[model samples]
Target: MKFVASLSAAAAALGALAMLPTTSAHGPETREEVVKFLDQQATAYHCAPAVAAYTAARKRSWAQKVLGGAPIADQNRFIDGYFEAKGLDGEVVKKGIKELEEEGKRIMACDPVVESKIRNSTCVLAPQSTEGPYYHTEAHPIRSNMAEWQLGLHFEMDVGVIDVETCEPVPNILVDLWHANATGHYAGHPEPAPHLRDEKPAASGLRRGLLSAYPRTNHVDTFLRGALPTDQNGVAHFVSTFPGYYTGRATHVHIKVHNEWSVLPNGSFTSGNLVHTGQFFFDDDLNESIDKLWPYNTNPIIALGRTRTRNWEDSLQIYQDAHDNGYMPTFDVEKIGGVLQDGLVGYITVGVNTSASYKPVWNPNSGRAGGVVEQKPIDKATHEEL
Candidate 1:
């Protein structure tokens, strides 16, 4: 009887081991790994009173030993607090609560949209990866509007920063953002992607290295990129065109969070700790709708009749931005007007551990953010422009 019990215990342990997620040295090599990691972090946030009593009541079950859990009215007030603290209009908070309650206890554990909304309200950690090849550190203007007369659908983004360790809003931190224009070209970089000009596909290896450092072209143009310090409420706003898709990736935006950063005399940020590097994506249905629009339809690569990669199809990187249960590195967008072309607004809350930092590599010869040009010839193989 003892031997039989030992064998069963061993079998059960192995089963649990098999259920754990596995990742490559580079990070989150599989979709399942990405989803599982996100779910775990989000679950941790909800289980603990990291931010508010609401989180505790959110997951409390009547069957649990603890009694007098927060009621639905309390939950509504908790949800309202976030918007009220942000100074948002009362109508918006009321509508947000209505929808949040409608979702009920299921929480749609795996749905990206639901997760995006939940994470936006609470301080949950965001994954730090996939800065992409086009990033030019310290080379973005400190301005609210990054559009610079670029032709595309207007987009306004409100990004909030929260220190996950304390579960509180973080102020004065620099948030830098960049993305492709309507025609699938990033401002300042001449090529859509490294060595993939003229409608050619980038190598799979290059796709995997989306977060790896690439040599900068040092181009002078700075459209579609901007930086700003978060306010006391830990929010920064920017106006830009909606991001268009590039080859080998989905429609996404790149973000970098900086701490102890200073603004340069040239109207750009200087030195700071790169605390978090991550990407945000739009839903595939939204992407498809935008692709039919004027300037986006004019993208030369897509004009060749090639289909762009969808969110799920870009298996390597998209999963890293998504959580299986709690968080998604995507925006909760709302139409500001009757149509998308009219205008759109999006909001995302970034959760970061202020104690952590990163040293990102970029082109040393890149031009300054304020229209100072330094042209250089890039070595295609090494992506090094010397």
Candidate 2:
């Protein structure tokens, strides 16, 4: 039997709402009014474009374990309302319903394909160390509060001519990405210690004098925002360090991809608008080292040593042969369980469009006090909505 990961009908519904008319003064309608309209549309199409069967399976498992019973109906209602509020109703709802039905039938018709487990052969045998103008210096203002050095890895996935419905590679897909820094820190304009200098006494490690403003060097803005072009083989490479793990969440990067059809309001192409959010994991040793420290130690998702590297290989140098002219590392997409493993590896193939199959696997606070998941509700208290 062929196994196919289900696509979220909510996504299709939301996509449709993006084409709807909004309310404005003499214009269409207010944001709230437009939101209400979409909600009604989504309600009308609720059952038609319900959540994917695969997603429902995972949720079913969780509900049974945690809720002691399957709240499938309640969950569906909540999801539908959430999508509706996001303005994904009407045409989008109809389209999503069709897509869901087609996907369900495909899964039911074929046996699932079993994927072979791949090994994470990459490792930082000798961790590279670099010195920075420490302690709020003019050049490197941010003081390192964490004991260990942190790294962040970013990925760009290219879905080469593979229609999700047909399971074939579609050429010329674009992926966009952004993420936090190694120290779980973010870099922004007018750095925190703009006035600090790097002339502190090394022996005493004490703050020296008023920091001087030096010309910014290596200002690549690694904090976030970058896109990569895929190769003929339908893969894109990113030169990034392993991202540090934080409290509550495991170590991972953020990524998104866009097809040719996705466009902006001005009829221009937008990058990474497909919206796929996923977290990547590292090897057992590195994870263990990270867990020994704070934040990650307390994080529930930081499962150390539980995940082992199946086929371990080391010392695969990138600059070994004359043909190696600083090309990006390469790995088989079918191998590594559809996710990038951690460490400074030269090449990785976590599978293109892995995020495309991604679904909300876990929700820490599903039915807690003051916890609610709406389609895209604006936080009235914060005046922020996503």
Candidate 3:
């Protein structure tokens, strides 16, 4: 992995390479550009390995594990020995911290809300929740607008990204999002369940549970699912509708962050390290307000007189996410138009370590992998050099 000497040479080389739909308007358009930026970033931020070690240590400590999240000084102590053990000078980490402090002051002087939202962006090695049953590696198009005429209140999301190790904004990374419709059904999955009662099952013994046997997707609908790249400011904007509640889970949205991924000819992606797999939750008041709307009020679970799960009641996943180390996975939402009937907008800053890696779990029930860590080489539309 050789680094380009200068941005001028990298830009000249990128002039001949093809661009993909996942490229941000202001971000790197080719793999060479991304690699160049990463090479420069690596020189300044060397705390990724140290942060990963601290996260693992926290999981092993019974006291820290019981308390949920540890203090900042305690976490710093855990990583203090890492630099000495790896023979890295401590001045590098100090320099990175000084740079972040300057940026934080500037952002605070500009807008307090922006600075406050990203203040706790720390690296989390684990996923907030398990990738639910409705995930597919192929056929997810790269676009901003994911709403395909689904009847519900409009939802506009602006997701901010930052490297937790250095607290610096991360650009050119892919943010993949998907959620349920107003009727509590996900697109491309028309199978009949307690929520979706229209289509038949793809297999005979497919059941509904986190550990139950799942079935492969039988349809090709990609509504309410899409991917977008972060701009120079490390933000990805998406348009959709507020998701309705499912049988066992609260109203939430699924998200995944892809680093160094390649776009295929079919508009899907492959050969990337999945750095983050998490879910974002909504406030109870907002979910309650949306529940009284027209289409959301007509869910099959409501028709069947079954109780919908709330955030507090969904203890296993939601509780862990809310109290997890350095991760605030809930969105801060507000009314977009004068009334809630028109639309809503939400914002959240996702903290991740770009250098960290995780393997995608294999699900024998569905015959498909859970998330993408890396895959075999293929012909990329961007002509990306893997």
Candidate 4:
């Protein structure tokens, strides 16, 4: 909306906003201060129209559906049109590209061995991304009704997979998705009357996240968690509600990519390749709107206290880190607009290796690798895993 003001003037305005005074370390502490701060973020980030972003996202979604794993440029054509049509700020675009370039160079210069190990593992794919705080590989990995949470903004995403080795689209890859509900509670993580998992939104004054202090009943009721395979064009679509944020993280969606995964005779996932893992990000401006919405705002932290859900900064940093290590930032999430209710579409291309033979290492009590990442020896000269 206001953020997308005439692009011709956006360069000057972003320059001005960049020079604005920074907020204190943790962010606005009081409710009134939080509101004022978020309002400022909305203005500064140039909140785009939910309709425009959603529409652009929707068109891109359809294109992905029909074209499947089409080249990124094809999808960008549609995305760029949306930004152009909405008159997106040139400064935002310019700054994003510049940052990407610098990050790219940095990643390219990392130790080849370390970069190899990183890229071979989920850590390198999605910019400091991890797996198994809560993941269901057995029962509900391919589900689509994740929106059953029944609260907060509705969200859907279309993921495109590219084979970095071949520079081509990869099809039939299984994509796993999960995130916290509007209350910052993830499905299967445990909630006694979980919907009422914590303070009533009206009560205010609660703002913790998925830290160990929270219960993990593992109810496995299966909301906001599922998996789908990419079509011929390397695209997998999902249905979900906008995620709620917790302490130390922004609003995000965790995605895992599995190659050679297939539905067995009973329709359960059998083969697993655990190729990629990363999180999708949202526009800071639109997040301000989510802060004021029901349930999401009700998360004790936001309703009663402060907002732990910082915006794009952390994701950008992680992306930079991954790029420095010579890998892509999981995927590129093209945001269409800010309105959370009408729903928006997200698109990203994840690069995966079809020939990877690494076994996943999970969180072993002894600090051993157990999940998607494996412990490997690093060569100092190359700072790479040998």
Candidate 5:
């Protein structure tokens, strides 16, 4: 994929651009001027209301209410009130307050026009880091004639836990899953052609039996959303093939977790709350090979790197951290060269139990406690971080 200059640099440039006051509270029309005006409005309001207020109260009297107050004090008070209302304790509230200060500074630095645009629309600077070959086929449909091999791209990943305060992994947690098929396609897309059922007499295909066959085709509702169970060693595995690249993003898998707490209405077990959202990658050779083709070439995030294995480890670590707080893990896959495609593996380890008060509904079949269970309490002998 063609690489754009670093997103951080772009943000820095935007920050610099924000400083140029090309437009006054009232001024001539120019792109720079428009951007400046928007930035100013953003600094004043910090939200859509600020922009609306600036526009409506351009007469200064309203401007004072939107911009003239003791901003730092007001911000502190607002954050305090927010934390209080949210039932956060002193530490969490303090952390949130600090984050707000940082955000406030970023907001203050933005050109009013840029800030206004951000508030008014979903536009923002591009990301500094790569996210994925995420699926975005809502607009066009994949052709059915695409060969199965051409359509399925393999993705593999690992999962684990994190520290709630710093968002880093603790250790030894299992992640499991299933995902969409290749061709950047998923099941239940409203347009159904590749059927997912079996009515004929004994026609079977690989990965197309049981769960695979019940939904029949990858195009039908089977690839992306099954909750897999973890084993005693805190590891889970899936047999999904790779997924194809999509525009603007990289290839990735979506996964949810099931822990000691997850339960179901029928007394069976469900997975734990989701813990991460990340992507897995193949080696550089694989990326280069894929980049030589279409779609993948157009993606901006793909890049050649010498330390792809390191990158893989780093990415997996991040996924584990994201899930530490009981959130599902999401990750991307980069097909590198020379890796074992068939046995591509991912791992995760849980750390300190952050879900102290989180009570999971009990599932008798899953062998977990509590109609609900929390992470804090564990079987001491096992030392399971859960």
Candidate 6:
């Protein structure tokens, strides 16, 4: 298998209690309340408008996840009392229910005609997580397509960005994505390799050029990893295959947002700030289906051969903890055709603070984390390598 791989500062009490209201001194009782609440809450959390929207709409432990967890009922009571104290009203209390109803309608009305439909889906703000041992910092360029692998069905994701500051779409931000291949292998990793490739990855032309360079691992196969900028509507459409499950983690994808970045004269990178770094997960049903499939069943680490298998291991408690904290976001999966081996679509919106700085360091040989490791190009005329 291939190796891969935030807290708001609210006081435990008052920060957990009120969190500055989205309504007004008078109260938000109409549709206009939507804009006001979104702006206010988004600004307070230093997140995106979509997050505020989901928090206000989902009406779950969002506050507890962000602020603190008392009890949902107790939290609601505190919120109502706090809203009353701040001069808000019932409309604000019921805003989340309305948002839920709207989301239900959208899910029921899913359409497949649009080639690049994602930002239009429901928005949810998620918790932040570390990139783990596998996040690479080498010079990988921005590209949209990531379906250059031999195994697994197609998985397309469209990332939507919400500018929490303006409660509007975040245009032109970079979306970085990376995941393991179906055989539980990551490109550029050199250890814990599979016993046999079945003459597959190479035979399929997927592991062609890079296989010879790095014999110890699949370091040359940069499959299922790429980056691209969001469009005007704050969206990036990506193509990839459903990833294979690896040891110590569940089925998930790693994401990072860079607000300002550029390639430099010396082949290095220059950037402005880190927008966001988080993950999106799949439905349990989807996970189970993948585990029971062909190449996924070939996962070198996981045992039991699919039946009764679950993604509940792999230092997985951290992810479960994040979900309990309400910082984890899940993609709305749409699997089409018989035997999920066909293809599917997953979507999620990331909220980010545009002002954060880019401070990242990659440690190769750090637990065999498989990701980008910079390599020098060879000079043809001089027969010299730099």
Candidate No. with top TM-score: 1
Candidate 5's C-alpha lDDT?
A: 0.32
Candidate 5 lDDT trough over 10 residues, lowest sum: 121-130
For candidate 6, lDDT tens digit of each residue in 1-386? 11000122222212322333321211223444423432333223323222333322222322334336333333432212122212112345334434434332222123111101222232333345556555557544467778774578787786767654444456677888887788766677645335443222222221221122123344455667788877654668788888776544566788888766786564334445465666666655667777777877777655533332243332424344334222335675554434466677665667654544434443321212223323234232221333
Candidate 6 structure lDDT = 0.48
Tell me the lDDT of model 2 at 46: 21
Write the number of the candidate with greater lDDT, choosing between 2 and 6: 6
Alpha-carbon deviation at 337 in model 2, angstroms: 22
TM-score of each: 0.65, 0.31, 0.60, 0.57, 0.32, 0.55
Tens-digit lDDT string for candidate 1 (83-148) = 232223334423433444423223423233333234434455676555555777657999999999
What is the Cα-based lDDT of residue 335 in candidate 3?
55
Clash-forming residue pairs, model 6: 2-184, 2-185, 48-164, 49-164, 57-96, 126-327, 127-327, 188-219, 248-314, 249-314
Estimate every model's Cα lDDT from 0 to 1: 0.57, 0.29, 0.57, 0.49, 0.32, 0.48
* Model 1, C-alpha of 279: deviation from truth (Å): 0.6
Query: Positional deviation of 268 in candidate 4, in angstroms?
Result: 3.8
Give the poorly placed runs of model 5, Cα more than 4 Å off.
1-178, 190-220, 260-285, 290-343, 346-386
Better model by lDDT, 4 or 6? 4
lDDT of 4 by residue, 149-257 (tens): 4676766676656554443345666778888888777776654444555543222222223233244577546778778887655567787887887654566777777
Which candidate achieves the best lDDT against the true structure?
1
Tell me how far the alpha carbon of residue 281 in candidate 6 is from the true structure, in angstroms, after superposition. Answer: 1.3
Superposed on all Cα atoms, the candidates' RMSDs to the truth, in angstroms, are: 13.0, 21.4, 17.4, 12.9, 20.0, 16.7
Can you tell me which runs of candidate 2 are displaced by over 4 Å? 1-115, 118-162, 189-224, 261-269, 272-275, 283-285, 290-343, 346-386
Ranking by TM-score: 1, 3, 4, 6, 5, 2
What does candidate 5's lDDT look like per residue over 1-386, in tens digits? 11122345435646565555532211224656444543433322222222122211111221134336323122321212223322223244335435454443344343334432223211111111212222222211111111234333343333333333332223333343333344334554422235533232122321111122222223433334333334332223344454453222233444323233344553234434423323333333444454444543443223422211222223213322332222222221222224434323333232223344333332212212223323464444443454
